[model samples]
Target chain A: MTDPREAGFVGRRSDGSLIRRPLSPHLQVYDMAQMTSALSIMHRITGVIWSAGTLLLVWWLMAAATGEAAFAAVQWFLGSFLGLLLLFGLTAAGWYHTLAGIRHLMWDAGRGFDLPSVYATGRAVLIGTAVLTVLTWVLLLLFWN
Target chain B: MADGKTVHEAALRTPLGRVRGLGSAKSGTHHWWMQRVTSLALLPLTLWFVISLIGLAGASYAETLAFIGAPVNAVLLLALIAATFHHMAAGLQVVVEDYVRGELRRKGLILLIQGGSALMALASAFAVLRIALAS
Candidate 1:
C-alpha cells in the first residue's frame, strides 16, 4: 500500500494513480438539451407545491366554518403582504401545473412524441401558464378592488 | 403447469395485455391512469374554484359563507375536495418513492402524506357541509 502521506486525503492506487471516488451525478453534470425535460421536472416540483398550497384552502374553509371572528382573523393574515406573496406564488404554481398537466394528457393520447412537437408543446405550456396567470391577476385587480 | 406457465397467459394475452404486463414495476400503469383521470376532473373543478374565489375576494364572511352554502357550490366543492386530495396523495407518493432512500423512512413518509391528505380532505369537506347545511 502506498504511504498515506503521498496521497494526502484522497486514496491512491499502488501504481500512483489516484483512486476514483464514487460520486453521484449532480446538477452540474446534467446537460438539459431541451425545454421539455425542464418543464417535465417543474411539473412534478410544482405539483408538490400545489399540494402543499392546498393547506391554505383548507385553512380558509375551516375558518369560514367556525364563525365571523375566526374567518376575519384568517382574512387579515391573507390580506397581509407576505400572504399576498404566497397567493401569487400559489397562483403561478397552479397555472403552471394545470398547463403542464394538459401537456401530459396529450402525451397520454399518443400525440406530441416527436422532438419538434415536444419542444413546441413545452413552449406552449410555458406561454400558456404566463398568460393565464397574468390574465387572472389583471382580472383580480380590475374587478376585485 | 406445463412450461411453468398458466394456460390463460398464453391463450388470452393481447398486445395491450403484453404492454400492461411488461413493465418492471408492473404497477405504475394504474397509478398513471388514476393521476390522469383526477387531473382531467380537476381541470374544470380548479377553474371553477379560481373563479369563485375571485368573486369572493374581499367579500364579507357572511357573503363568502353564503356563496359556499349554495347547493351547487357545495356539491362542486365536495367533488373538488375528493379529486384534488386523491390526486395530491398519488402525486406526492411518487415523489416520496423517487427521493426517499431509507425503506422505513420512505414508507413512513408515504403513510404520512396519505394520512394527512385524507385528514385535510375530510376537514375541508366537513367545513363545506357544515356551512351548506347548518348555516
Candidate 2:
C-alpha cells in the first residue's frame, strides 16, 4: 500500500492516497522522424478526421435528395474557396488512411517487418498520399471543369 | 516424502486480467475483422465514388441526379455509403477507446459514434433510394 508502483495513477498510493507527479515526456519529446510512431499516430488522427468528415457526406446526400435548390446550395458552397479547402483536407485524409490501411494489411500478413522496409514503406505512404491527392485534383480540374 | 511435497499451481490469468474481471470485451475481434473487410471493399468503391463525383461536378442538377439514379451508380453509392460509415464507426471506436477517458465519457462517446454513424448511413441510403427510385 505504501509503494507507488502498485498505484494505477501517477500520483496515487495503493491505500487510496494521492500525490502529484510531474507529467512524463509525451508527444513533444518523441522523435517523430521514426516512421513507426509517426505513422501510427497519423493513422488514428486521420481516422478521426475522416469520422467527422462523414457528416459532410451525409449533408451532401440529404441535400441532393431534398431538392435541386438544396443540392445547388451545397454544391455552390463546395465549389467555393473554403469548400475546396475542406474537400482537399478530406481527400488528403482519405488517401492517407487508405495507404496506411494497405500498409497495415501488409503487416497483418507479416510482409513488411524488416526495419529497412518499414521505414521505406513509411516514407512511401507519405509520398504516395501526396501524389494521389494532387493527381486526383488535377484529374478533377481537367474533367470536371 | 515425494507425495508429501506441496505443489503450487500456476495462475491462469494475469494479476491485471483478474482485476479487470473481463479480459477483453470480446467485440474487438469482430471490430478488427469488419474494419479490414470494409477497408478492402472501400478501396475500389472510393475510387469509383471520387471518379463519379468528378465526372458529375460541373453537370446540371438533373445530370447529377440522373447519375445517382443510374442503376450501377445507385447500387455502388449505396454500398459505399454503408461500408464507409461502418468503417468509420469501427475506426473511431478504437480511437475513442484509446484516448477518451472516464467510464461515462468513453461509453457515451462510443454509443454516440455507433448510433450517429448508423443514423447517417440509413439516411444516406434512403437519399440514394429516393434518387434511384423516383425516376
Candidate 3:
C-alpha cells in the first residue's frame, strides 16, 4: 500500500522542509523609471485621502446650512490643534494631487515623455506642490481674518 | 465512435448556438469613459472655482452666499459638485481595488464609496439650491 504522505501533492524541499510559493511583488521592487507611473500612483493616494477629507467639507457645509450655533461648533473643531494638523495634511495632499494632475495632462497631450524630461518634470511636481502649499498657508494666515 | 471523439466534441453547447452573436460584457466601459469625460470637464470647472473663491476672499458669509447664488455661479457650482463627486467615486473605486484584497471587503468598500459619494453629491446639490433659491 502507498503511504498517504508519499502522494505527489505532498512535497518537500531538498532540505526536507515544506516548499513555499514566492512572495508577491511589492513597493520594494517598484521601478521609479517612469514619471507617469509615479504621478498616477500619487494621484490615487491623494484621491483616497481627499475622499476621507470630504467629511470635513460635509461637516462645514451642514453646519453652515443649519445655524450659527452649528457653524460655531464646526469653527471650534477646525480651530483646534488636531483640526489644524488635518488641514495641513489635506492642503499638502491637494497641492500634490493637483500639480501631479497637471503633469498627467501634459503627458496625455503628447508632451514630456522623454527620459530626462520625465525625471525633471517629476522633480518639478514635488517642489511645486511644496511651494504651493506654503504659499497657500501663508496667504490664508495673512488674509483670512 | 468513442475513440474518435475529441475534447472539443465533449464540450456542451446550448440552444443559444455558437452563431448567436452574444457580445462581451462591456458595462465597465461606461464607468471608465464617464470618469475621463468628467475629468476633462473639471479641468475648467476647477479653475473657475479657484478664481471664484479668490474673488470672494475676505467677504462675509452673506456676501459669499450671495456671490454663489448668482445665476452663472449657481449653475457652475452645481456642475462642479456633480462632476467632482463622479470623479471622486471613480478614483475611490481604483483605490479600493488596490488596497482591499479580499472579495467581500472589496465589494463593501466599493458600495460604501458609491453610496457615500451619491449622498454627498445630492446633499451638496440641495444646499446649493437652498442658497440659490432663498428669497
Check candidate 3 and list the clashing pairs: none
**Fnat of each candidate:** 0.61, 0.66, 0.18
Q: Which model, 2 or 3, shows the larger DockQ?
A: 2
Report residue B100 deviation for candidate 2 (angstroms). 1.6
Query: lDDT ranking from best to worst?
Result: 1, 2, 3
Clashes found in each candidate (C-alpha, N, C closer than 3 A): 0, 1, 0
lDDT of 1 by residue, B12-81 (tens): 5677867778554567478878888999999999999999888887898889999999999999999999
Cα error, residue B112 of model 3, in Å, equals: 1.4
Predicted candidate 3 versus true structure: per-residue lDDT over A9-103, tens digit per residue:
33345765554322232345567565556676787789779778878766765665666687678767877899878988988997787777777
Q: What RMSD does model 1 have?
A: 9.9
Query: Candidate 3 i-RMS (Å)?
Result: 9.4
For model 1, name the residue pairs that clash. none
**CAPRI quality level assigned to candidate 3 from its DockQ score:** incorrect
TM-score of each: 0.81, 0.82, 0.73
lDDT of each residue in A19-109, candidate 1, tens digit only = 5332322234456675756787789889999998999999999999999899998899989998888899999999999998998899889
Q: Taking candidate 1, what TM-score does its chain B reach relative to the real chain B?
A: 0.80
DockQ-derived CAPRI band for the predicted complex in model 1: acceptable
Interface root mean square deviation per prediction: 9.9, 8.3, 9.4
